[model samples]
Target: MTDSESVRQDTHPSGTWDDIKELPPSAKLVAKVLEHNEAMTQQTIAEETLLPDRTVRYALNRLDEKNTISSSFSVMDARRQLYTLDINP
Candidate 1:
């Protein structure tokens, strides 16, 4: 990879961790859950984390604001968005 690309990759995890550290506890829990799983819908995340749906939604918004997580519409369920970690944990 190019030097810039290498540097970006090397620093991304630490940067992401720093951002995550500033987030609320609920957002941190959501990040942890995404770290362990491949990808999950908000409902699935709520179930896995045992958090309320509203809390999960709030956490997701926080994570998204930090660019620590990415989401895409699920193929099987258009209404559901699958969330995944954008950084390595």
Candidate 2:
């Protein structure tokens, strides 16, 4: 196999983490938190990461743009959204 392909496989087995690894610090932090937890809201992420609400929002956007994360309306509060890593990627 080609060296580049080998490197890709070695670095990003899921292809999801590799893309997230390239994102900004806040995005990476959010991804890591989600990696451990089943799911969390934007507020929960902000509290867990100790990042500002705005930063958390921005990070979530970045993750969404890369298709690394997915969101669904919260069952507890439809106004709130729950975010989780896209395992299929």
Candidate 3:
């Protein structure tokens, strides 16, 4: 959600949290994971969104291909991923 939209949701309880249901299936799931937690790996996306890991991986790959988001990995756990919205893109 945008800053203004979040502010509006804060003031109102008109299905604000249901924004996830309004998104395109894949983006919707990704949005939910990002909203609740800090950074998310494909694993986190799978667990949080109830999407299969392969599905999450594909969606994330598509997001990257479109330059819609960015990701990195933790040094301690190379498999642990971190994602960030690519506002500049």
Q: Please write out the lDDT profile of model 2 over residues 1-89, one tens digit for every residue.
A: 11221111111122367787779999998998988887788999999999999999999999888877767766556677777777454
- Rank list by lDDT: 1, 2, 3
RMSD of 2: 11.6
Model 2 scores worst on lDDT over the 10 consecutive residues at 1-10
TM-score for each model? 0.80, 0.79, 0.60
Best by TM-score: 1
Pairing residues by index, what is the TM-score of model 3? 0.60
Error of 3 at 14 (Å): 30
The residue pairs found clashing in candidate 1 are: none
Candidate numbers sorted by TM-score from highest down? 1, 2, 3
lDDT of 3 by residue, 22-56 (tens): 34578756755665665666776788888888888
Better of 1 and 2 by TM-score: 1
lDDT of 1 by residue, 1-89 (tens): 11222112112322277888989999999999988887788999999999999999999999888888777666665676777788754
| Residue 38 in model 3: lDDT | 56
Q: C-alpha displacement of 51 in model 3, angstroms? A: 0.4
